[model samples]
Target: MIGLSLNRVLAVLIKEFKQLTRDRVTYAMMLAIPVVQLTLFGYAINSDPRHLPTAVLAQEDSRYARSLVSALKNSDYFDFVAQARSPAELDEMIRRGEVQFAVTIPGDFSRRVARGDQAQLLVEADATDPSATSGAVAALAALPDQALAHDLTGALAMRGQAVKPFEVIVHRRYNPEAITAYNIVPGLLGIILSLTLVMMTALSVTRETERGTMETLLATPLEPLEVMAGKLAPYVMVGLVQTAIILAMAATLFHVPMSGGWLGLSAGIGLFITGSLALGFLISTVARSQLQAMQMSFFYILPSILLSGFMFPFRGMPAWAQWIGEAIPVTHFLRVVRGSLLKGQGIGDQWRELAALGAFVCVVTALAMARYRRTLD
Candidate 1:
C-alpha cells in the first residue's frame, strides 16, 4: 500500500505543470534564448571581418597607382573611406582606428616600375585586431600583378614582369602572429561573467519577494546598503572564481599570454564584477517578479554580446555604433582585458578602462540604491 500512489503523483505533476504554464517569462526564455543565441551567434558573428574603412595616399598620379587603388577597393576588404593628403594624415587615420589600412603609393612608382626599378608600396594596417587586418594584408601580395596587367603590354611586353614589379610592405603591428585565440579568449571573461553574475544577482532580491521574505527583511533593522552588500559580496568571490577558471583554461588550452600585472587585471575584474552586481541589483528593483528580473537581465545581456567587441572588431563598426558601444560596460572591460592580456599593458596603460569601470560601478550603485525599496508595501 505504501509502495506507490498513482493518483497523488499525477495530481502533484498536474499542479507543477499548471505552475510552469503561469510563469510565462520562464517558458518564453526556455524557447527563445536558444533560437536568439543561435541566430545571433551564427549569423551576426563574423571572424573574417570585411569592408574595412580605408584611406588612400596616392603620391603618384599615374595610371598604375590608380589601378592599384582600384584593385584594393575591388578586393572587398578596403572600403576607400577617405583620401589622405599626407603621410601624417594617413598615420592619424590609422592611429585613431578610423581607417584599417592606408595605401601609400610613393612618387614615381609607375615610372620606377616601367624602368624595371624595384618599387615599394606601403600598406599600413591597424593590426590591433590581427584577424581583421591579416585577410586584407594577404590580398595585397597579388595586387602588383593584377593592377599592372594592362601596363605589362606593348613596349613592356618583353619585360612584362618588370612593368608591374612592386613589393607590398605590410605592417602588422599589435598581434603579429595574427592569433585568433589571442583576440577571442580574453573577451570570453566579460561575456561569461556578465551572463552568470548579472543573472544571479538579478534574481536575489526578486527571489526574496517571491518567497515572502521581503516583508520579513523590511521588519528587520537592515538598511538597503547592508542588504545590497550582503547580496553582492558573496558573488564577488564567485566572480573571482569564474575569472580564475576562464584564465586558467585560456592559458592551458589556448596558450593566451598574460603579459600584464595580475594586480591590475584583478582590479579590473573586481570592478567589473561589482558593476555587474550593481546592474543586477538595479534590475531586481524594477522587476516585479523573478521572471521579470530575468527578462530585464537579458535586455542588457544581448546588447553587451553584440556591441562589446567580443565577436567582431570594435573599430570595424560605424561611428554611431561606436558611440553606443562606449556606453556599454563590457566594451570598456574588453579593452582592459585585451590590453593587459595580449599587449602587456601595465596599470598605467590600463588606467583609462579601470577608471571607466570604477565610474560605472559608482553610477550603477547609486542607481541601485535609489531604486531599491525598503518595503513590499
Candidate 2:
C-alpha cells in the first residue's frame, strides 16, 4: 500500500473548501438556517402567552362586575376586545376564533352577591390549543377570592372571609379534554402536504435540468402555465392521497373527531396543494440544481413549521413572527383544517382563511410563470 501523503490530503481539503464556498445557496443555508432557528426559538416563541383576546358579555352594570373585569385585566392574561351582546354572540365569537376567552356575567350577579347567594361567573375558553389557555385558566382560581375584595369590606366582610365570593365556572370549549392530538392531528395534514408537495415538485423539475432533459422541454411549444400545470397535476393527486392517508389515521388511530364541514375541508386541502406545487415551481425556477432546490425548500419549510402554529401556539409568537406566519400558506391551511374538523366551521365562517390560501395560489402561480424562461437561461 502507498504511504499516506499529508500534502495531497491538504490540497484536496482546500479544493473542497473552494467548492463549498462557490455554492452560495448551500453556504447561505448553513449560516442563515441556524440564525433563523435561534432567533425564532429564542425570541419569537413563548409557551406562556399573555394578553389573549377576550370577549365580555356583561348583563349587569354593577361595581362588583366592574371589579371582576378589572381583576381579570390586572392578571395580564385577558385583553377585552369585544363586548358580546348575547350568549349566542359569545359562542359565535369563540367559534370563529375571534377571542380566546368569553366572559359572561349574569344579570343577577350583583344581586346574588349582595344576598350572599351562589353567584356564578361563566368563563368559556377556546381550548383548541390547551397550552395557550392553560395559564389563563389557572389564574382564574385566585380571582374568586380576590376579585371582589374591596366590595365586600364593611357589611360583606363575612362573605369574603367565611365563604368564597363567587364561583368562576370555566367551560372549555372544542377539545374540552385538552387532548394534544386533537390539535396536532389536523395540523399534521397541512405540514405533511407543505413539506412533501413543495420538495417533490421542486426536485422533479430541477432533476430534469440536471439530467439534461430540460433541453427537450425547451424545444417544445408549451407555455409556462401549461408546463407548470402539467408538471404539477400528478403531484396534486399525490398530495391528496397523502391527505387522505393522514386523515384516515387521525380518525381511526387517534380518534380525532371530524365534527363536520366536509366541503370546507376539501376546499382547503385542494387550495393548499395547488399553492404548495406552485411554490415548488417557483423554487425550481430560482434554483440551478436539485441540491439548490432542496436547500431552498428547507428554507421555506422550517419557517412554515415553526411559525405556522404547528410546533408552537400562533398567538404565543411575537407580533413580527405572527405577521410572518400570516403570510405562510401553512398558517391559513392549519386554521382551515382545525376549524373544519374540530370546530365544525363552514365555508361562510372560514372564508377569510380560504381566501388567503386562494390568494397564495394565485400569487405563487403568477410568480412561477414570471420566473420561468422557455430558453432555459
Which candidate has the top score in TM-score?
A: 2
lDDT of 1 by residue, 178-213 (tens): 787887889989999999999999999999988989
Total backbone clashes of model 1?
0
Evaluated against the true structure, the overall lDDT of model 1 is 0.82
Model 2 ranges off by over 4 Å = none
Whole-model Cα lDDT of every candidate shown, in order: 0.82, 0.92
What residue pairs are clashing in model 2? none
- TM-score of model 1 relative to the true fold? 0.75
Q: RMSD of each candidate?
A: 4.6, 1.2
Worst 10 residues of 1 by lDDT: 39-48
